[model samples]
Target: MRRPRAETRWAYVFLLPWLIGLVVFQAGPMVASLVLSFTDYDLIDSPRFAGLGNYAKMAQDPKVARAVGNTVLYTLSHVPLAIVLALALALVLNRVTGRAAGVFRTIFYLPSMTPYVAVGVLFLFLLNGQAGMVNQFLGLFGVQGPQWTTDPDWVLPGIVLMSLWNLGSTTIILFAALRNVPKELTEAAMIDGAGPWQRLRAVTLPMISSALFFVVIINTITSLQMFDQVYTMFFGNQIAQQSSGDAALFYVVYLFQQGFQFLHMGYASALAWLLFAVIAVITLVQVRVGRRLVYYEAEEHAG
Candidate 1:
């Protein structure tokens, strides 16, 4: 069943473009960035070796601490809610056995496909302090709407809400996972006099744990890199001096400010490395924890 040498050569030839691209574009830049992280490299001047200066400064940087805190807060607030909401929607859609379900799925997914800038703009207008639709709706009930973008206390919540608006993709992913759950298992549970909740707890959920874990990992990675919405909504003149109590100041946004806005390329590279480290640790932890929960029908098949 082994390939001939000629076939193997052809396979490698086909992969040559990607291999070359990795070296030239991906690997080259990554290595360069690592090197740059150790130096003080302003765009206008040659990089000077500074060893751990950038990292040392990071430990003492108030802005970096604030950005990290905000990012963590946003992730903790948004990811769990998004996962639950998406899974609930997906479960509902999975039970619908007609064209209506398909239409509804597409409608839900449409927002995720829409451009981030458009979503940011739409939310900004919708959540505007005095004139926004959300506030106006609240006014009808005599409940004053908080300044979502401008008030520090409300800024992170606004960003978390905005992030939830694109939960369609997660819903679709969970829907697919739910569909793959074997119906016979649920029927067996029902035959044992199990109710709906019992069936789901004993059968459906365990079957889809792998997919759920995957979604959590993907969401964590995405949340750590959140930038476009914050940049589009609050960067520069749009950001009031003390907007949202600085709640919207995410880690990636701070990195962007350091590298592009402040021209602290070296420092930004260090921050990028730190972000990578955090993500790596988190992913490892997820994998370890998931090992206990993830189930595979293939294992039963093999056994």
Candidate 2:
């Protein structure tokens, strides 16, 4: 049953590049970062051993606390909304076929494919307080539009809206998952006099639950790491100082401020590790909870 020596050698040869890359690129930096997390390495000076000083400071840092709250708020606001909206769009798209379906799918995905920087800039113009297109359009309706990017009450909402603009990919994934559901099952449910809502609840939902679970998990992780949009749109403005108010001061933004702007590399490293741990725990919890609901077609097939 053993493989020939030549085949074993070929297998090793095929894996050699990946092994080398792992050691040199991934493994090396990961170990280095772990060590750096425990030291004061401000990029300009020699790294000094700090043991747990960075973590201790993080515990008392107001900015860290604010960032954590903002991140949680952003995730709560965006993740569920994105998933639901994407799934709904996907469900609608699933009923269509041929060129129309393709056209609609491409249209939905175009926003996601657009550069984040471009999206940020576009939103900045659209959401501008006085001269922006959105406010101007609202003015015609006799409704006064608040300052979206500038007003504290509206900044987070603006950020959430901007984030949802890129739900096209999620929509496509959900559409594919919906399409993969067996037509025979749906037909059988229909023959049983099941209504549209009943069929969706009993048949469609359970079948696509796994994909839904995956989309939620992915959205949670991505929302936590939101940076480019906030940075490009809001950073270096009066809003940055308004962290006490409606500022979208997310965790990664605070980490960036600590590492580069404030030159607190060791503290930033600790924050990074803490974020990693938090994400790991959340992901594990999601998987555990998801086990109760996720349905695998392969398992059904095997059963």
Top-TM-score structure, candidate number: 1
Local distance difference test, candidate 1: 0.88
Please, what are the lDDT tens digits per residue for candidate 1 over residues 1-303?
356988999999999999999999999998999999999988889999999999999999998999999999888988899999998999899888888998999998998998988888788888889799989999999999999889888888888988989998899999998999888988889899999889878898899888889999999999999998777788743555356546677899999988998899999999999999999999999999888789877887999
Per-residue C-alpha lDDT of model 2 across residues 124-233, encoded as one tens digit per residue: 88888889888899999999998887778888888898898999989999999999998999999999999999999999999999999999999999999999888878
RMSD of 1: 1.8
Worst 10 residues of 1 by lDDT: 236-245
lDDT score at residue 36, model 1, on the 0-100 scale: 93
- What Cα-based lDDT does every candidate model obtain? 0.88, 0.88
User: Residue 93 of model 2: what lDDT?
Assistant: 97
Residue 107 error, candidate 2, Å: 1.6
The runs of at least 3 residues in candidate 1 whose Cα sits more than 4 Å from the true structure, single-residue gaps closed, are 1-3, 239-242
